[model samples]
Target: MQANTVEQIAEVQRKYEELQQQFRAEAAEREAAAAAATREVEQRKKYDELQLQLQQMIQMF
Candidate 1:
């Protein structure tokens, strides 16, 4: 009986570790996606600013 209990405990620990790994992977993916989105937004903002500057220069000409 003790051996069986030990096996059961080991199995549970293994499953817990797997779940923790899965969660960590998902979190990493989400962080990457957020970073990408932030970069895209910064790029867009820069492009918009450049466009406005160009428009102003054209008007001056």
Candidate 2:
């Protein structure tokens, strides 16, 4: 009976470790996606500014 109990405890610990690892991987993936989205937003802002400047220059001609 004691041996069975020990085995069960070990199994539980192993599962806990696996879950922790999975959570870490998911968090990292989310962080990377957020960073990419931020970069895209910055790029769009720059593009819009450039477009506005081009329009203004054309109007002066």
Candidate 3:
């Protein structure tokens, strides 16, 4: 191939790699946020259960 054609191909390849990297990073961030939200929901559920138990114990007394 000609030199200019080769350079253009290389530039396109670089841009494609950069876009792939950005997409991967965005996916990782989304996964991390989802995991954090799941953990928070679990914690809230546990807290609610504990509160119910405490109220039941108080009622017994």
Candidate lDDT values, in order: 1.00, 1.00, 0.99
Q: Provide the global lDDT of candidate 3 against the true structure.
A: 0.99
TM-score of each predicted structure versus truth:
0.98, 0.88, 0.95
Candidate 2 residue spans exceeding 4 A from truth: none
Enumerate clash totals for all models, in the order shown: 0, 0, 0
> Model 3: runs farther than 4 Å from truth?
none
Best by TM-score: 1
Instruction: State the TM-score for model 1.
Output: 0.98
Q: Any idea what lDDT model 2 has? A: 1.00
Q: How do the candidates rank by TM-score, highest first?
A: 1, 3, 2
lDDT of 2 by residue, 3-39 (tens): 9999999999999999999999999999999999999
Candidate 1: where is the Cα deviation over 4 Å? Answer: none
lDDT string, candidate 3, 1-61, tens digits:
6999999999999999999999999999999999999999999999999999999999999
RMSD of each: 0.4, 1.0, 1.0
Q: Is candidate 1 or candidate 3 better by TM-score?
A: 1
